[model samples]
Target: MALTVDKLINDDRFCGDNVFQFVAFLPFALLLLVARVFLALFLWIASIILPNKSAVRQMLSTLACWTFGVYVKTKGTRDPRCSVMVANYVSCLDSLAASHVLGTISLRKWKVPPFFASTLGIRNAAQFVRKQHFADCPNKPVLLQPEGGPTNGKGLLKFTDWPFQIGNRVQPVAITVERLFTNVTVHRQSDARDKFPWSDALWFLCTPVTVFQLRLLPPLERLDDDDNVFAARLRQTLAEALEVEMTEFKWEELNRGSTATRREPPAELVRLARQVKEVLPRVPMRDIMRDLSVTRSVDVTITNFLEGVTPFTPEPSDAPTPSTSQAQPRYVTPVPTGVFPKSAKERQLSFQEKKAQMIADARKRYIERHGLSLALNNC
Candidate 1:
């Protein structure tokens, strides 16, 4: 299969391409969602009371996983000596599941509540001096999802180079999240713009069960000075392990295309801009479109142009006249013919004055063409 942004990102909420099953399970999913909310709250409180790494805390972590219907099955032993652990990011819960199995601390850059972070074994990057500080903590491997953000399990996004800078030896962990009844394991990229990480947690709670299959590969030592090459090698290893294609896509591309930043102008505004263009043929289409976007009215845009409130370079030549095949006559104001001024003193007309003169001339021509002088006299 050819790789594309759409193929890598999960753009739909329903799995197996079935909407009927989602509708049928809605009521039961809602009930489960409510129950999971309370359970999550309880888990948060328990995490605060119990000490980190205590037997009771470990049990609570296991219980929390069971409560949220998360079953983690791991293969291969994690290296005790490797301080940095790199993983393929699939969902928000990847850290939670990885921490439970490997006893590692996942570095989170985004703002997450203290209770939620504690429950999920996540530490804010702000807590550390630099990411390298994570290696100082004894017996705890520092987990980094170098893909930068989550994607659907179909492909691996290009890995970031910074994660490999923390340590010379890093362990690669391949994670795959699968839902029993549905393919909707995580939120779509479009939904991510508005929704928080907890929103994905809520969806996980609504599902019947989510299975996380983690395969821990042996630690790989950096053979060269380049961190990017090492990061790429690790990315390829994970992609092969997960049986997914490797992609050159980055998380920044995903954010740039989100609904919040990217939007199409309204059809009405475009139509208004075209109308304004007809009247102000000397003004560039972009300038007219810019004014129409804000004013959203042809009359307002035209008035702005007439009053010199909007600044724009007048087109040097008149717009092309319509074809003769059309029945209606087009009145195009002719461009003024003039010789280039030889001296600076001779070309004293300022830009604003020249624009004003052009507008006045166009208005006079329009009035004469439409015989509006007789109509004005009657008014």
Candidate 2:
């Protein structure tokens, strides 16, 4: 069908040859350039005039992404509205993956283009270190690749400088691409000289037909709360999400909490470094401290990290919360009835609609104590 369409477009005998028509239309391409220049200018201007204007930035990002091929997927508990989230950048796919999960409807899209979603926050750019003038714009909560370079599951490379510069604990995520996005990069650069940005080269490459997989874990962290702890956890979680074999040495226990302690280096590490050099080098020992921070053991301290969510925060003292009974068959007391439907499927029942599901409900305490998955069910 596409071949036929192409044929039809090139067939001069038909209404018009698409190839010729496209080239002919170039005479008016300046109009498009003017439009884009203005659009970018207007956005930059509006963003400046309006303080913390998130909606406009979001619209711009969505529109830009709509022109590309991508989307977002979010799981676990997160407030999409949180403007300062840090996440890992895996093949540049984390942004879209999180956006889809956020459930923000795009105000625009291609008539017949790949699915594109976007999670636009603000971008944090620094003042000039050189002579170049830096425009002040809203910071975007984007995915950052801690390992400054790309990693195909080799041991975690020391993270990039962005994590520290951004000052926002990144939401580390893994981008799983069944097929590498190499073509996208190649074609994109090929078109750099041409008027078209070789966007199509990637369009076919990023198509979902062959690209099927879950996004690696997302960076849903508070950077200020715990710096080293969060980054280390994010690295491990990202590795696990991709089913990558992580490297570990003795004293391989993991840190369960979201925060890391300023403790001494593990015995194993100090021992190994000793064997390599008689005199320990006096370098910034942060890396040595970090190596001992997280462990590979299952007993890693995670409980202490996810504390402080009161789903039961009283709705204003005066307002009464209607405690209408849930239609679920109360299993308060498991009275055994041999006749109680041998097949559990027989007892499976539909639940009555819930009016509200709070974000705090997604906490582990809530899930364990209440046995409820506090997520937007329909979503």
Candidate 3:
């Protein structure tokens, strides 16, 4: 399917596109955010105290869903025979909703706190393998998001093959998340590029309500099909179910696009670098420009330079003067009044002094050459 980057990823914010609505809802959103912080803390501590499979933990999970404004509705029954459940990634809470309804352990690739992952039924790849290897396994099935990352719910990303390789029969679960007041479900813009999972969670708290609809499809047996074919078929099945187009776009492409968008213009970078150079005259312009490109803030670049977080070689100052040919007619040149520093550090330290002295010497020369002093005397 031919799909643009905007169709695959959400480029909007939680505050939304309407300036008037954003301003009207700002106070309520802030209040809700502060309350959710405490509620999340309580849920975190409770998850730690209680066992993963305990009834109390389950109740806490339900309470978390209610408190955080997450409502999940399941349409079809999950197959008991399938060990692996592949789903379309839509939001950070996809696993949480699936785990609550289907009792499935979602495979996580990113590093999160142990309790946090446990609370959300997220397991690392190693833990997933260990669980599959061990004789005593939990009754819950393994949930895998083959898309590797979340999208805007408008399209399905190409599925990876490893999830299909895990088991012969895989269940396809289609999850659709909808939020009130804003079109943004997951952040894919350049500004929130680095603040992922946390940013998503914060938006969830800010939003009044988020509804998740999960449709569980029947188990598909691989039979004679290879991993790639099996994965493609499953992806097509999900696309049909979700009523969205299947795109060849991957998470890597999304990351590259966001990075490209984050890059500042050349003029902006130069301006920021000059500001940093003003504060740190000893720091080379090249180093300042490099750091400014990444930080994109004059204050941050200056702080990084002062903290010695940025390592750089001092700019070269001492160079041999060009040799003149003896055969050429040479005119007598006046000796320089200002002293030149041999080292970069010395030059940086005495730059202002040298500048002032040069200006004074130039003024003196102009007076002598043009007879300005004689004119002043006559006046």
Candidate 4:
């Protein structure tokens, strides 16, 4: 429990501290890195020349397993029966464990770790949904982290609906970590720091003995085929199986935490600005610009204007309305011509008279459409 440099060096378990584990696994880790790079290179070239690309991917997957200690568990077989794999994401290593041991393609983000993006491009064994076109892929199995981004393994974020939309049975794969040396879970919202995925991988790979428990749940087949319901059910299933809390925390909230800076204006200002946007939903942009009178396009200065104006903005008459001379012409509705008689006497009928005539005409039309006998019966 006492983690120190001295303890790491002297500890016999060696897995007690990350520093010790890093020292122990440094050589093997380096070798594994080089090996994976070369394997990725081989797969890239082989994919072009080799007639059996699956075989090459198999070899790459095997190499990946050797690089990291990946262990798989399932109810029946290690391989999943479905085409799409949905999992509760913990770290980027989930991609590796699933790809190597399960021999499935991981769907990743637009940006991944440099090591992953550079070697084998992750494209070799995994796929990026945004970057690649995998909708019509002939391959049976593809992996997806419905949570969108990694969590602390204590909470499950909202699941994406894409997996259910795939038109195939979803295999809910739960990847949980049993830490031996260091916490393999990436800290929540640490992605704002440059190259976060790489840092997570370092913690995972340098650990002396980290076992990844990959469990492939029963394939889900929905009758109603509702994306939201299916996604929610699958998320709940994974959460319960993995023993993590299902949360409403979304990607926006996560990124918001990461990018939140001290330079933000007062919370009161932000809340007031939001209220202004809500109430004056259709407020013209030019009016806002005129009120702010901001010469520069910087965000903070504009926010400051909004904060000041929203709370104390006066009524329309009190406010400076846009120039009427410069405003567009108002639209006028044309008067109905023939709903009444053409004679001036009839045309000049009172409002009550007009209403009575319109009602009579409507009743007449309804009676004619329904027939006199049916209309009388209804009455």
Candidate 5:
């Protein structure tokens, strides 16, 4: 049976959506890029001369929204009173998408790259602060991603406590993008392969019209509230509003994708190769391995690719169940829940605490499995 073009186009995951996007909007998308560059050049010149940022910001914001054909659906405007803002990360485009609506203020961090230094310096919009100086920029509100990294819009990762620690009214901004077959989200944890933040931002060119829904919720006051508890509750509020499940995936997992810093391939890639081989056996394993370039050896590659490769055992369909079967899957209770009672403050445990606990637990288990007797005997 010959596979027709129509049959091939029906697979939304790969060629189908891309082919349609290319046919419909590739030229227009290229034109938009040209226009954006021209506008950005003009904005830079105007800023140097006029030194009026509000006007420049408005123009840039308008250009970004128009160039992307962004459709913004908001619940409420950003609270003017709040000095700290926390938003759920969707993609690199989230900043541009929110700029027009939210009026982004300077989000001071420890340090920013030289490339970002000038761009963010337009209105002295972004500041650099060390560990002791988060409050250095008192005029402008600090924008933060409590998730610490991007995720597929369908879910929310664990939230960090940076936003709540500022001791200001924390405004929660929940943003989501609606796409057909192309996922515009730049999740570092996933197999989607864009290296830099700029490349991730420009990925919107793959789709025709990107629809972003930016919702601004009421600000939460830090009155007598613990930072960890506040951070957790704020995350919960955003997760609920965004209609996405709160994921256990940590921020460190996301940073594993940073080519400049990270040394290892994401564990997700290995799982993906296994799933791909199962469903699409015709797909080339060599191609996948080459793209990842994590391990060269076939045996090691296969071991990583297939996480659970065990020796084959015969199973007779008519055989009776064994009474003392240790072969039955050993059920392990969930760490966070099992250790802490429901009535306790487990839900309030911040990402940092949970992460530390997880490391400690892993260490304990390792020590138990391979006892200290070996080291003592060697001594």
Candidate 6:
């Protein structure tokens, strides 16, 4: 009798820790089987029909995550206009947290398959794989976790070929899951179901993780640099962010110019927009201006900022969920979108208010600094 490749691979888990894990994870495995079926059916329908399919997908993803014991919180601020975003792969759940934090501000079409294939959230994320020129498109921003596969948040891998080309800013994201669930071993680099983490039943059922840190690293220095150089800079930033050692990989660095800055509009960019305005006719000036904005905020701050931009968000929605989701077609609510401080004295109060705020901040900083110094001195 001859052993098939599948048998050769599945026949053993090197440590036989595989057996212990399988027995221990029996409950999770059964749950995953049931959940996968349920989610797959729901997501399939959503992928085909739900009008705001992304939201539906996110809702389901969040719900599934809640079912598990994982929840997330973002930590820092991100730039408003930095367009492109990427991150390392830890678990499939990272997709949900990323999308939720990014919200509608980032135009997200479902891209990755297998990991996110079942969710409507990744409906068209595959399109991002190409090197397209997206200068002033009104659509939501795009995101990618370019490894296109999962790995322990260990060493870095090559990113997809976009960071150096797209006119929008490319921001890197860091998701920290306290305990990792990854394949302990790779055989021939083939997709094997018998792997350690991937084999876990609970891995299939997406769970909301505790302490989801959407750490947005600084924007890539340049979008037009050599792919190798651009990737080097990107990996360098991600490693610094997550504090992981980088593993060298094949790369092509290009000398694309810097389109990553938020201020100082490029002359050609302005000219191109002008040409489009002439050729296209009656494009909204405000919308075009919004398109011209720069990007580079981190996930944590971006989340808070978008909430601030969202009109009436802090006050709570004027409408209910199922109802409001239908009525006005929610655009990405901008934090501090259109609300201006009251005119005259109120507007004048801006400086006084900022000064007061500065004083308060200074005092707090002093207290913290003094307290830390006292502790060190005591030690």
lDDT of 3 at 110: 57
Model 2, span 235-286: residue lDDT tens: 6777666655443311111111111222334675555434222111221244
User: Which whole-number lDDT from 0 to 100 does residue 329 have in model 3?
Assistant: 18
The TM-score ranking, best first, is 3, 1, 5, 4, 6, 2
The lDDT per prediction is 0.70, 0.34, 0.70, 0.53, 0.53, 0.46
lDDT of 3 by residue, 1-379 (tens): 2345545666556435667877798799889989888988888888777765558767876867865678899988888888788899888888889878887888776577877777677777755564443345556788888887788888888776573256788899999988766654544444232233777677778888899999999889899898888888899999999999988878767656555545547988888787666445556899898776565666556556555578776554343343443233121223433677898998875765554444344334434543332211110
Candidate 5 C-alpha lDDT tens digits along 1-379: 2111111111122333467755675577677777666755665565456544666656656655555556677788677777677888766566666656666643323233432323342122233342334465444555677665566665677776563346548889888877654656433333332233554456454455778888889888877778777788888889888876776656555445333223444565666565434322333655554433433233333343233222222222342344543354222223454454364465566444665454343433433443322111110
Order of models, best lDDT first: 1, 3, 5, 4, 6, 2
Show where candidate 3 strays beyond 4 Å. 14-18, 130-134, 183-196, 261-379
On lDDT, who's better, 5 or 6?
5
Clashes of each: 0, 30, 0, 0, 0, 51
lDDT of 2 at 68: 37
Query: lDDT per residue, candidate 6, 1-379, as tens digits?
Result: 1111121121122334456665666576566557666766665565566554655756756654554444667777776677667677555456556766664222233333443434423424434443342443334455566654444455555565543355435677876655333332222333422222344324434322334578877776574686567666777788788876664331111101111232345664565445333322223433333433322222212222223331111222233234323444211212222346777887666655554443333333333533321111110
Residue 188 in model 5: shift from native, Å? 6.2
Cα lDDT of model 5 overall?
Answer: 0.53
Reference-based TM-score, model 5: 0.56
